[model samples]
Target: MNKFVYWVPAFIWIAVIYYSSSTPYEKQDIKPWLGDWVNLSWAGPYLERISFTYNNQEVSVAAQGIAGFIEFFIRKGAHIGVFFVLAFLIYFALFYTVQQNKNKPLLAASAWAGTVLYAVFDEWHQGLTPNRTPYAGDVLLDAFGGGLAVFVILSVHRKNGRKKKFNIE
Candidate 1:
């Protein structure tokens, strides 16, 4: 029962991810709210200078306008931040549920692998949702988020001198 408790947070987070992915992109757009809250005219020149092709579409303030330009980054940042927390929750669950004496490196790797797999699943789900386009780059971003969380956890353990517990080999 206690082991099941350890897994609850990860499961809940997975559900939350699924719910978010199921929402149509039109419903999730926050550009109107952003436009109402602040003046972005001053940012136009700087944002306009930044432009790139993503998934065969041009992404720029000139193309999307100031509010949309800001929203674009917010959405991308959410992908990284959400996956980072998910990775940590998964690592915590694994730490308590896995057999004793396994090194922390193995646990962290497992958590990261789980995170990347979920990221792939999430993009696939988004592909099925209305107005949502799954980009491979977003999956890479999610993996980077998971990797970052593992790096921080390993660093903390190393700094605390838990050499035997955190050993890679």
Candidate 2:
């Protein structure tokens, strides 16, 4: 019962994000959101700050980087990357939380499965939402997100191990 309770919130939160992301909003609402995210947050300033002049126009390096890297490649397909990231991160979170305890592998796998399923369902939910169109491209992003989480967590583990070896030697 205790372990089940711990698992409940992770699944619920991921489910909520999955469903909500699929819900369509007015373009007016979306525009502000995009603006707020890319133009108002720390990313906004960071992007704006790292600009360079080209043809008398100061272009944000961060914006260019994001566009050229994350968006450009991702636009080619949905479900190729980001959604996986969502899944992977969730798995990493689950594993990290349970690292010092028992049943780490089972808990991690369950979280990973939940994340991937959530992405799939999220795409389905998008199909039903108004003003939103389901794109396999987004699903790709989700997958990428998951893969990235795996990369990050694994990297951290490796780094810590290396650091411990260095200290001992």
Judging by TM-score against the true structure, name the best candidate: 1
Task: State the lDDT at 122 in candidate 2.
Answer: 78
Ten contiguous residues minimizing lDDT sum, candidate 1:
160-169
lDDT computed for candidate 2: 0.56
Each model's TM-score, in the order given? 0.92, 0.54
Model 1: per-residue Cα lDDT over 1-169, one tens digit each = 6798999999999999999999998889899998998888999988789999878888899899999989989998998999999999999999999887768999999999999999999999999998998989999999999999999988987877765667744
Candidate 2 at 52: error in angstroms?
A: 23
lDDT of 2 by residue, 12-78 (tens): 7666666566656553243343444664344444454565553344445464543332233333333
- Residue 109, candidate 2: alpha-carbon lDDT: 56
Report how far off residue 168 is in candidate 2 (Å): 5.5
Candidate 1 whole-model C-alpha lDDT, 0 to 1? 0.92
